[model samples]
Target: MLSRMKGSKILITGASSGIGKAVAFELARRGVKLTLASRRLDSLRDVVEEIQSAFPEAPQPLIARCDVTRRKDVKRMVEECVRRFGGIDVLINNAGTGVYGNAEFTAIEDFRAVMEVNFFGAVRCMMEALPFLKQAEKGLVINITSVAAKHGVPYLGAYGASKAALAVFSQSFRSELKESGVSLMIVYPSYTQTDFFRNEKKVGGARRPRGPYASPQKVARAIVRAAESGKRNLVLSLEGKALTFSQGVFPRLVERAMDRIAYKLREKQEVFNE
Candidate 1:
């Protein structure tokens, strides 16, 4: 079923910046009522102002300070959405943190922290909003994950694991959501030109992959299209699509490539060893 954007009450996490912020703008432009949640209230205010400036006639966005890792915060945020918008028609789980380092050197605690936000954070939001979502004409849940969720990269294993966990969990939960009006969509975004790298925890000297990163604005547009078209899984970028195909067709070859990448990264990053 096609999801309606206009008039829908939407809640987007991590909307202070990056993909989440971009999505908020896109939704607002479509006349959807928005509740933008992030730890940075000031940044979210800026986003609201920008959106209002872009579309004066559109619905103004409501900003909430939310740290997805906390159960109480997530609950309060969702309730605020319902109180303000009546009910949530769409939930975009875009809040996430990253850990940049090799598996061996990356602290287990770092992995846990990422998982708390990237995985459990989404879970908390869904659990809280499912009831409200089910009441809507066609409720939508968009899980903004990553390409790392699809393939385990060298330095991104920790981050990947977090997204991968969310992706895997989404599969089962989606099935359970069958017969329910609510629908789930998982978005696997590739490297994007975002501050994620600079904001991420750097455990060791790992040279980041040289990549053609996708812009958050571009990704946001794709997500909006997918939402309207009711696409189940959205994989952005040709490289990600190719990797998905290659993994299935040539599993051994893919493993070999990853091995080579791991070697290169380890060798290249040694120069910056701390």
Candidate 2:
């Protein structure tokens, strides 16, 4: 159901900053009622203020402190969204954390933590929001997965695995909900200009991926477009598309290329330290 976003009620996680914050602003400009959730209430307030300043005509967004890793918090967040805005027309599962360093060096606990937030976190939100979504005339669930999910990368092995798991689940869930009024959309955004790198949990010092970073605003716009167009999947960059395609066709070759790139990144980090 390709409809305008003007009055849709949407709930977005990880809205404190980065892509989530950008998405909030973009949707606000479109006149959507929003519920922004994150663990950081102060940051969420700042985002709300920014949106009010920019899109004064838009409805004031509701904010809640939600740690997606916790089921109670997720439930409360969903309850609050429905309480404030009637029912959720769209749910954007964007809250995620990353872990850096080779899997060998990463602790099991750290890896599990990554999965809890990146994979299970989305699962919790989806499960909790399904009822409200199904009640809406045209409901959409957008899972913000990464390009790393396509092929496990070097330093981000845990992060990649977590996102890959979420991607697979989204695919299956889409089929299960096909008869229902809810639609599922998966977004694959490559390295984007955001504070995600700075906030990443690291087992060792790893350099962030360099260059060709898409702006958060650009990615947010693409997401809004996908929601309106009812696209099942949206890969936001040419590089991301190429990487995904090459990995599918020549898996071993792409693996070797990624290894070389990882080596260079590690070597650069070493040089900087020296």
Candidate 3:
């Protein structure tokens, strides 16, 4: 378990928007020194300015450029954060992308791209941050996986697979880092109102939004608390948790049920678009 945020040096990737941006705000309120990273420097600067204005007394956050898909960029971001803050207390691998496509029809490149951002991207960040994480008196790693990780969905084939891989990686990585005094937590978030859909790649065209989704701020608060509590893994949303648990306990039945739902959703989207 780690101490509650008093003066922890934290780095959050994808900090320009969504859960990452919200987490940055919440952490700043708690007096954590932040190193906010994203691909967009302008957005990063905007978040930094917003937070600084809100918490004028707090330490100004460092905004670093990071493209999670590029290993070198991830390393540079971590190194820059360490240079700015001395060492990293917590690293949140929150940068990811999505794709909406059927398994058979989904281009291999698209699947690889999703995997690069959602899975390998996290891996790159973790690898780069490992040195500084080891240096911290107490270390935490939070991988922002998705609820789709535990369950199958049709349009989100590649995105789901990537998040599933991330969950598995976090589980395994947690085991390895436990004895090293580094805590790793996998956060499984259900659909949330974020820019994910805006930037999400389309399969046939016009991606569909289905089921329950929570606010990003709510999930961000949960993440900060999870880090404070040193939770191993957390799943947000009641419906999402139920679906994940059901899938795990009865894989075949859930798969069958979801298959029917996926078929219906695809048909619905096709009809609606036409």
Candidate 4:
């Protein structure tokens, strides 16, 4: 599978850190041509330096500073990737933002903001890259979603909605692009040990769950392997697969469990502000 990706032109959003960063390193090791992007230029430079040092023979990646929320940034990033790499064979939509709180008090605008990044951001990249992807022999789009998308958690209602939207969008769009030779892969990863929680917009009233997080490297390897193997849907962690199963077999039981968790997590607190 790794040999299959060698020298393939691939673009990854949110490549500055976390799963994106880890994926960048893994793919570089696999000898893929890359265009690594994020909103932060400095961090991306650091990634390049590290990748160059570790894998001197690997094809050097093109770094683009992109904020997925902006149409201009996404469009320009794709254009530059095509200009530099000739064409894009793989598009990895890993950029996302989340707000933490109950849906009632998280503010509708916050939900929209999350949607802009988590949902529309991926959409923008897909729409921009679809043509190039179709031109490739077997173009692939990998959407990094979450297991939370399967269940609406208490404090993460907004985040869940955004991922759910992306998952559903990917499902429908996958079929649309099938005949075009463009395949879409949806990855539902469980809680990962990343800066995501530290950077999340905390709406208070609830605390994050502590425990059993998957490392970014582990998730990254899984994603790359899934793409190489041409897997359509990849769900990480035993918890994620179980959640998917229980939802189908015992819906009300699962809802009751969530209700209990929300009750225990609920408390009075002020929302964090900028």
Model 4 lDDT per residue over 1-274, tens place = 3356579999999999999999999999988999999999999999999999999999989999999989999999999999999999999999988788767777788889999999999999999999999988778899999998998877788999999999999999998886898889999999899999888887744457685999999999899888878789999999899889999999998999888877766533323222
Task: Give candidate 2 misplaced runs (Cα > 4 Å).
Answer: 1-5, 269-274
What order do candidates take by lDDT, descending? 2, 4, 1, 3
- For candidate 1, lDDT tens digit of each residue in 134-224? 9998988999999888878777888999999999999999999989988999999998888787788877655577669899999999999
Better of 1 and 2 by TM-score: 1
| Backbone clash count for every predicted candidate, in the order shown | 0, 0, 0, 0
lDDT of each structure?
Answer: 0.88, 0.90, 0.86, 0.89
What is the TM-score ranking, best to worst? 1, 4, 2, 3
Pick by TM-score: which candidate is best?
Answer: 1
The per-prediction CA RMSD against the true structure, in angstroms, equals: 1.5, 2.0, 2.0, 2.2
What does the lDDT come to for candidate 1? 0.88
Of candidate 4, the 10-residue stretch with the lowest lDDT total is 265-274
Evaluate residue 201 in candidate 4 and report its C-alpha lDDT on the 0 to 100 scale.
Answer: 83
Residues 98-200 of candidate 3: C-alpha lDDT, one tens digit per residue: 9876666777999999999999999988888888889888888999999888886766778999999999988888888878878888899988999988898
